[model samples]
Target chain A: AQSVTQLDSQVPVFEEAPVELRCNYSSSVSVYLFWYVQYPNQGLQLLLKYLSGSTLVKGINGFEAEFNKSQTSFHLRKPSVHISDTAEYFCAVSDRNSGYALNFGKGTSLLVTP
Target chain B: DTAVSQTPKYLVTQMGNDKSIKCEQNLGHDTMYWYKQDSKKFLKIMFSYNNKELIINETVPNRFSPKSPDKAHLNLHINSLELGDSAVYFCASVDRTNNSPLHFGNGTRLTVT
Candidate 1:
């Protein structure tokens, strides 16, 4: 079975400050990684994904993530965040072979303050 | 237009009662999925259908059943609802061939009394 671990339960940062949300996964075989964001009372939206491609993947809203194979990590980062960026973020992993169902992390709540 | 839509955005019902949540997708995707988001905001996959056929069925209780009328619609029917079932249910669609991203609906929040 595959599992995802989001180290930070919640991260608080001031507006315009850079932010990083850590994520790690455990899988026996090749895996696909994804990041999703859910705003207040809204559904989850895909932020970015990493399949069999470049290690650095860029997403909408100026967010990006790098897939580290050796560390088994796919951490989401943003050069700077705005108050509108406040939302709950989730990291998920799916097996490359099967890739049937995604295994999600507990989630990291990003709180951006003015 | 909403890419994915679920009816009864908020459902408040009594325990042991029966209820159903309908989901439809307009993206012409062949794969649809149901996911549950608990109070803590952790999303878990409940079921998935591909071309109206069951594909991924999680360890959900027997009381929960998913019916797909066609490739564009997937409905979830819950019997004898429990307090533990009070959560946000999200419907998503994806195109497996393109390895496309999953598009999610605004989720139906079900509250049990």
Candidate 2:
């Protein structure tokens, strides 16, 4: 079974400040990692994914994540955040063991203040 | 055009009632899924359909049933809804052939009163 852990429940930052959201996973098999952003009253949108090859994955909206195999972690980071960036972020994992199932983390709420 | 769309973005009904949420995908994906987000913002997969075939159940309560009449439509029907059933139901679709990212609908917020 694959389980995802989002270290922080909520993160507060001023506009233009760098932000990082930590995520960790536990799985015995190789898995696909993904980051999704959910705006208020909107559905979750894919930010980026780490399938294979590169450890550093860049996504839309100037967000990027580094996948570390040794640490079993995929942390999302942005050089700077905007007030529009405030949203709920989720880390998800999908492995061969769990067919068609994306195990999602509890989610980290990002509050970008001006 | 919306890649994934679900009807009745907001639903409020009394307990013990029966309701259904409709979903459709224009992405021409063969696989679709239903995910539930609880009040705490935790997401869990409830059902997945591939090529109109039921692929995963995920230990979801039998009260929830998924029906796919075609490749692009998957509808969820809940029987005997309870207060605990109040949550956001998101429908997503993906092309399993190349492992594409899942496209999600706006979601239906169901509130059981």
Candidate 3:
């Protein structure tokens, strides 16, 4: 079975500061990586996805993530964050051969303060 | 219009009662799924349907049943709901062929008291 691990449970940063949420996955075969964000009282939304070809994937809200196959990591990063960027971010992985059911990690809470 | 929509955005009911949450997707995706978000903010897949056929059924309790009338709609019915069943349930859909991104509904917050 595949699983995702998010090292940071909570990350606090000031507005306009850069942020990075670390994510690592364990899988036996090729995998697809994704990042989803959930705002307060709302459902999860796709931030970005890495299917193939590109190692660096850019997402909405000026966020981006790089897929490192050797390290088994897909860490989400943003050069600068706004207060509106504060939310819970989840890292997920799906085996290429398996169905579309995603394996999500325990979300990382991003708190951006002014 | 909402890409994915679930009825009764907030449902509060007593324990032992039965309730159903209806979900519909306008994106015309062939795959739909039900995910449960617990208090700890862990999202787990409960059920998945492809073209109105059950594809993946996780180790969820039998009390939680999912029915897909067609490729565009999937509904979840819970029997004898318990306190542990109180959480946010999300309905999502995806285009199976392209490995498209999953589109999620706003979610239905079910509270059992």
DockQ leader = 3
In the range B1-113, model 3's lDDT, one tens digit per residue, is: 99999999999999999999999999989999999999999999999999999989999999999999899999999999999999999999999788898899999999999
Off by over 4 Å in 1: A96-99
- Give the per-residue lDDT digits (tens) of candidate 1, residues A1-114: 889999999999999999999999999998889999999999888999998779999998999999999999999999999999999999998774444567799999999999
Report residue B18 deviation for candidate 2 (angstroms): 0.7
Which of the predicted structures, 2 or 3, would earn the higher DockQ when compared with the native?
A: 3
Could you give me the TM-score of model 3 versus the true structure? Answer: 0.98
**Residue-by-residue lDDT tens digits, candidate 2, B1-113:** 99999999999999999999999999999999999999998999999999999998888778999999998999999999999999999999988878787889999999999
Off by over 4 Å in 2: none
Question: How would you encode candidate 3's per-residue C-alpha lDDT over A10-45 as one tens digit per residue?
Answer: 999999999999999999988989999999998898
Q: Model 2 in CAPRI terms: which quality?
A: high
Model 2: per-residue Cα lDDT over A1-114, one tens digit each: 789999999999999999999999999999899999999988999999999999999999999999999999999999999999999999999977777468899999999999
lDDT of each: 0.93, 0.95, 0.95
